[model samples]
Structures are given as structure tokens and as C-alpha cells.
Target: MIDGLSFSLLTPPLIAFTVTLILTGWLIKNNVLKVLDHPNPRSLHTRAVRRTGGLGMMLGVAISWASIPAALPISVSLGVALLVLVSFADDIFGLPVLGRLLMHGAVAIWFSVALLSEARGWMVATIITISVVWMINLYNFMDGSDGLAGGMTLIGFTCYGLTALLAGNESFAVINFCIAAAAAAFLIFNFYPARIFMGDAGAIPLGFLAASLGMIGWTKGLWPPWLPVLVFSPFIADASVTLAKRCLSGEKFWQAHRAHYYQRMVRSGLGHRNTALLGYILMVSAGVSAMWAAHEDIAVQLGVGIVWGGIYLSMMIVSERYLERCPGD
Candidate 1:
């Protein structure tokens, strides 16, 4: 058996897991959750369910961070806090598009300034910030179905945790493990035909954390840049391509729609569960590719992303064709 498995080492994740469970249970008991947001022409759910499950995820992270002894850098903490705040507000009050974008940009700047300070220059910082913000929004866009957001978090963090362990970064490994555990707890309630939705609150913060942690690992030389990109390849492909198509067609970029590739697949009668599982498989493939590319050349890393993008595009085209053939709604 592995030695030194003590409570202190395990405390953070336990705290997070317990907090999520308690918060979710309380929300259910108090009926504080909104159940009136019934499925419509654009929604994936067929019935009314609680739409604030993201609150539980936020609570988990908050409690986890609070329990730790300032182990994380101040800037990272601040960036995450900003994201949680904006996401929570969006979940509750529905902020305007520009407001959300501005807040996201601010958080991205903070994250870059804090974490990438030692990096070469402003150009790198700009790239990191843009990538972070894009990831945050992409994650939010993908959270429409049950288990989707939480599963993605769990998958990404699980890889991070493994990488940390291999690199002997025990503290960072623990942090990633805590995140994975928290997401897994949320997943218990977030599975197909979910009892609660994660909403923007959980998805945005989770995505931010994932992106930030990946950056931290890269900066520390524990992993390469391709790792995080590989981890989130599915969301990036789906959201980016869909957005490109919409922009090409002159649709308002900020307006919500049901044209996401996964959404289209679901509308094609694949069902949300199957579509989500398919995305999960794609994410796992990316993770596997990242692991293999850890010691390989940059070309291999870029190649993996390119191949995955091709596969994603092929699936999207097929799904779009199927959507075309379906009867009008």
C-alpha cells in the first residue's frame, strides 16, 4: 500500500466533497432552486429541474480554497474569485452580454498577470489571457446538458492530478485531486436527466480553474502547453467551429442558439446522454494524446490537435446533414 495517506493530505478534497453534497441537499430541501425553466425549442432537457447545481460546485471550490492555508498564489485566488462572482451573478440575475464579457476579460488579465509574470513578455500574457477567456466562455456554452460540464472538469483535472504525481508535485497534485473529487461529487447529481443543472456559475469557474492549473503546470515546466489544449479539445472544437459558422452566416455572436454541434447531434435523435458520452470519449482521446506527446516533439502535439479537429469537424458535418433532413420543428 502507498504510505503517508494522512488526513491533512486528504482534508481539502474531503471538505470540498462534503460541502457540495450538503449544499446540494440543502437546495433540494429548501426548494430554493428554480424548477420552472422548462425545456423549450432550444433546451436539452424535457422536464423542469433545478437550474442552480453550479452553486454546489462553487461552494465546493470556495470551501476547498478556504480550508487550504493560502497554498495557492494570491493572483490565482483573485482571478478565480472574480470568475465565481460574475458567474454566480449570471446564474442568478442574468447579466448583460457586455457586462459578462468585460468581467471575463478582467479575470483573464488578472490570471495572466499573476501566473505568467515570469513569462517572456506582454505578447505571451495577451495570448494566455485570450485563451483563458475563450476557454471560460466555451465551457459555459457546453454546460447545457447534465453531466457535461462536470464530466469535463473531472476528466481534465484527473489528467492534471496524474501528471503532478508523476512529476512529484505533491501539493499541486492534491489541488487537482480536490478539484476532480469535487466535480465527481457534483456529477452524482448531474448525470443524464439531471436533477440539477450546473448553470453558468459552475461551468465558468471550473473552466477557469482548469485553464489556470494547466498554465501553472506549464510555467513550472511540469507539462507543456498542449496538455490543457488537449484536455479541452472537444469544447474548443465544438464551440469554435459553431461560432465561426454563425459569424459567417451573420448571426449575432452573443445571442443564444441551439446550433452547437452537440446540440445538433441531440436534435438528430442521438439523445443528450449519448451525445455527452461521445464528447467524453473525444475528451479522453485528447487526454491520451497529451500523455503520449508529453515527451515528444511539438509537431506531435500540434498533430494530435489537428487530427482531433478534423474528426470533430467530420462529425459536425454529418450531424448538420442529419439536422437538415429532419422535419421542421
Candidate 2:
């Protein structure tokens, strides 16, 4: 038998794997998943498939919490539970936009309040709340293609896990490991030629957890703020620029459309798998930049930011050109 095996090393991933298998099997058997999901004209898939894969993610997280000894902060745990509930309800019954936004706002406030009660100052609390809400939504918006969100979570948690290990933050490392394992299992079904999609249910909560953990890591001085930003830089640049352009053109931001850079690439005949791989390439580059910047001076960090900004602008230009040439919607 393995000596001194802790729940941290054993339980989270195994529990997540078991939960995903059971959830997927149940959804397939009861047809509850099919009631809300169907192949549509705008979709990339060819057949009807379940879309509430986020249920599995939430279940995995819950199991992780139970398996470990006070593994996560009470506030953080509650916040994640709230997000999962709202997201799952929306997946099944479709929540009003205002209600969803309100829920996100409430969770952000709760996190801020909890952190502040722990002696964090007001300004820091404000920044944390805004950043958490924004990152959660960004993850939700970026969940447009197969394996995209899951892949992002995998890379992000891996980076954070390493950072925690190097910093000797073993508890945080366990949390990140759990996240990475959950994302990995989801990716098995979410990869290109997906058997199922994560829908908003999984995407939003995953995003919230990733963003929250990154923030916590930064606040505790275990990692720099730049690290999480670098891990999610590709999605950030694309979503930010696209939203800005849409606002400038007076387009309805909430309505669905094929306008993101990745979407444009797909329209230009780049396969979804290829587009996702390209995103992974960019994420890897950003991860390398982050690792290099961890020890660099302020000037070097600023220079890196400038270089990344230029690269983002160039990609946007290319994407715009591709969209212009593609057939009209």
C-alpha cells in the first residue's frame, strides 16, 4: 500500500472522475439533458447532445471539499456554490439577463466582504470584486467552441499549481490540482468532435473558480497578478477588443453572433480543432512570458506588456480581414 497517502493527493481527481461518469450516464438515461439542448443551425455539432456538463464540475468540486480538511475558504466555497446553482438553473429554465447579472454582482460582493473581514482593505476589496466578476464573464463568453474553456482551465490551473508548489503553498496546490483534474476529465468529452458541450453551467463556474483562485494566490503573495493575466491573456485580448469594437459599431452585445477572433478564423476555413490549438499556442507563449517575468524588473514587465499588446492588435487586424472576406451571416 502507498504510505501516508493524503486525501489531497488521492481523492479530488478520483471523486471528480467518478462524478463525471455518473452524471453523464444519468443525463444520457433520463433525457433531462436533451430537454434544454438541441443541435441548432448556428451550432458546429451534427447531433443532439447534453450541454449541462457543468453539473459534473460542480459535483467534483463539492466532493473535493468534502474529501479535504477545510480545503477552501468558506466564502470562496459559498461563492462557487452560488454560481453553480444560478448557472444550472439558467441551463435548465433560462434565467433573465438582469437576474444573472444580479447574481454575479451579489457573489462578487460576498467575496469582497469576506476578504475585507479578514483584514484586507477597501480598495483591494473593490479591485478583487470587479476582477472576479469580469473574469467569470470572460470565461463564460470564451466558451464558444469545443474544448476551449476546458483547455483554458487546464492550462491555468497547471500554471497556478506549479506556482503554488514553488511557493510552498501546499494547500493552494491541492486546490489547483483538483481544478486541473476536473477540467481534464471534462475535456475528454468536450474536445473537438465533442460528445457533449459544457454549456454556460460549467463554463461560468469554472471561470469563477479559476479567477478566484488566481486572485487568492496573488493576495497571499504566492504569485504575481501578472501570472493569471498571462495565462488568460489570449481570451482577455480577444474578448476585450471584440466588445470594444461592437460597442463602437452600436451592435447588440448580448445577442449571439460569430464575431470573436476565433469564430472568424472558423469562418475562414480554419477547423475548430486547429483554431483551439492556435489558442493553446498563444496561451503557452503567454505562460512562458509569465514565467520569465516572474523574476524580471518593472521595466521588463512593462516592456513585455507592450510587446503583447502589439501582438494582440496584429491578431485583431488579421481576424477582421478574415471576417470581411467570409460570407455574410
Candidate 3:
């Protein structure tokens, strides 16, 4: 009785949203995991809060995936599972940074080489593998602020779902929509004055999915490879630039710090709520533009990239000037 992209197709995301909302609320109320993120020199928040929101969000995603008939590639599914297990371990018992990086590299290589090498060749796959590893770490780097990662996940995955739908890939759309929906629910508790954090367990897997799913969509002709880059340009830009700056200054890039543009914005009196709002604006604009340019010719897509590149450059300059003028107000 329903029309195209009807109830059946939409049910999975709704289930995902509901499950995450209920589960996240329960975890917060009961202090289920007792994983507390306390304030630290590098932290943005001043008080301790639960960091088990990732557990609820991922459980929601897993349950929703179980109900859907569409199956992700076995390599991707296994890679995500491994990340969740290891990241959750890192969350509870402090794992060595070297060990975590090795695991991330192994998973990235597994996903990229095992699945992508035949289609894109080993050289291209190697580059993608490195990008996947960067995405994993960059996501964790950007998860310091309230609502930042959650908002990015919701907007970024929704863009992926929309592009897949436009490409007539209903199953793929459902998968992405499920991710966005779960992120949306997670945002309820993660917004300014956060009740919980997604921790490494959530950020790591979400980052992997962002890169791997985007690659899958590209290989399947759902969208161009660059579209994913454009959709997530906000995160990629900030993290990449910050890392480069640190490395050039002879600072250890791997150590946690509050030097990200967003972190500085918050510390410079922008506050978490406004900083997150600005981030959401950037994310939504990038996502919408990527979706619009998905089916256009090469020139239009290139224009989109150039325009965003300029915007990011200008924003970074403005942030730098502001920091110099304010000087830790």
C-alpha cells in the first residue's frame, strides 16, 4: 500500500533510533558500565561523566543490523567487530597507545587489502588503508567536545544514505540511515553539558564505517570517492591541519592535546554549545553540497571542493586571529 522508499525500507532506521535512545537513557540512569571520563589537562569538560554511551549506540546499530536482510561485506563486518572489542577494552582498561595504533593499522590493512585491492589495485588500496587509519585516529581526536562527533556522524551518514537512495541502492541507503539514526539518538545525551561520552569504542568504529562505507559506495557507483571526502571534509580538514602543525613544531602528534581548532574555540570562550553549533553548520553545509554535486559533471564537483577549501582556509585564519587577540580570555 505504501509508495517508494516506504515503511518497510524506513523501519530499520526508526528501530535503530528508538533502540539507541532507550538504551542510552538506561545506561545513563543506571550507570551501567561505570566508565567515567574525568576532567584532565587535555579534557574540555570540568566534571566526570559516563563514557559508555558508545556501548548503547553500538548495540542499537548491531540490533538494527540483525533485523535487516541486507548484509555488509564480511570483511567490513568483521573489521568493525574487532574494532569494537578492542576499543571497548581500551576504554575500560587503559591500553598502550602503541598497541592500539597497531590494531588500527591491522584492521585498516585487512579491510582495504582484502576487499579493495582487486578492484582498485594494491597501490590505491594502500593509500586508502592509510587514509582509513587516519580517519580512525582523527575521529578520536575530534571527539573531545560535546556533541561534535555525534553531530558529525548524524549529518555525514545521512548524506551517504541520501546519495545511495538517489543512486537506487535501497539496501545501502538503509544501512547508512541506520547509522545516522543511531547517532541522532546518541546526540540526546551527548549534547552540550553532556551526560555521556562515546569513548574510543564508539568513535573508532564510527570512523572506520565512515571510510569503509564510503569506499564501498564508490566501488558500487553510488557516489564518487571524493564525495565522501567532501562530505566529511570538516573533520578531515581540522584533524589533518592540526596534526601537520604539531608535527612541524616537533610536538608529538600522537599524544592527546587540546589544540584542535574546536578545542581552542571552546577554551577561547566560544563554549561547547556554540562551538558545536558552528560545527553542525559546517557539517550540514558540506553534506548538502556533496549531495547536490554527487551526480554533476567533474567541473561542478571540483568547484564544490575548491569552494569548501577556501572556506576552511578562511575559517582557520579567522580562528588564529581570534586566538591571538583574546589570548586565553
lDDT for each candidate structure: 0.78, 0.77, 0.90
In the predicted model 3, the residue pairs found to clash are: none
- Relative to the unseen true structure, what is the C-alpha lDDT of residue 159 in candidate 2, on a scale of 0 to 100? 78
The residue-by-residue lDDT of candidate 2 on 1-329, one tens digit each, is: 65554645666667766777677556545765564467565555567777877787677767875776646777788888888888888887889988998888888878777778553699988988888788788788888788888888878787787788778877777778777777778887778877677777788877777778877888788877777887788888877777787889898877666677777776677877998888888887887787677668989988888898898889877766667875323
Q: Specify the highest-TM-score model's number.
A: 3
Better of 1 and 2 by lDDT: 1
Clash pairs detected, candidate 2: 54-202
Candidate number achieving the greatest lDDT relative to the actual structure: 3
* Ranking of all candidate structures by their lDDT, best first: 3, 1, 2
- Which of the two, 1 or 2, has more TM-score? 1
lDDT of 3 by residue, 225-280 (tens): 89889999999999999999999988888888887898888988889999999999
Write down the TM-score for model 1: 0.91
- lDDT digits (tens) for residues 1-329 of candidate 1: 43565564588888878888888767656765663456777687888777677778777877786766538776667777777778777767878989999988888888788765667689999999998888888898888876777888888888887787778787787788788878888888888868778777778877788778888889888888778887778788878987888889888877778878777677778887887788789778788778777868888767876887787779877766778854222
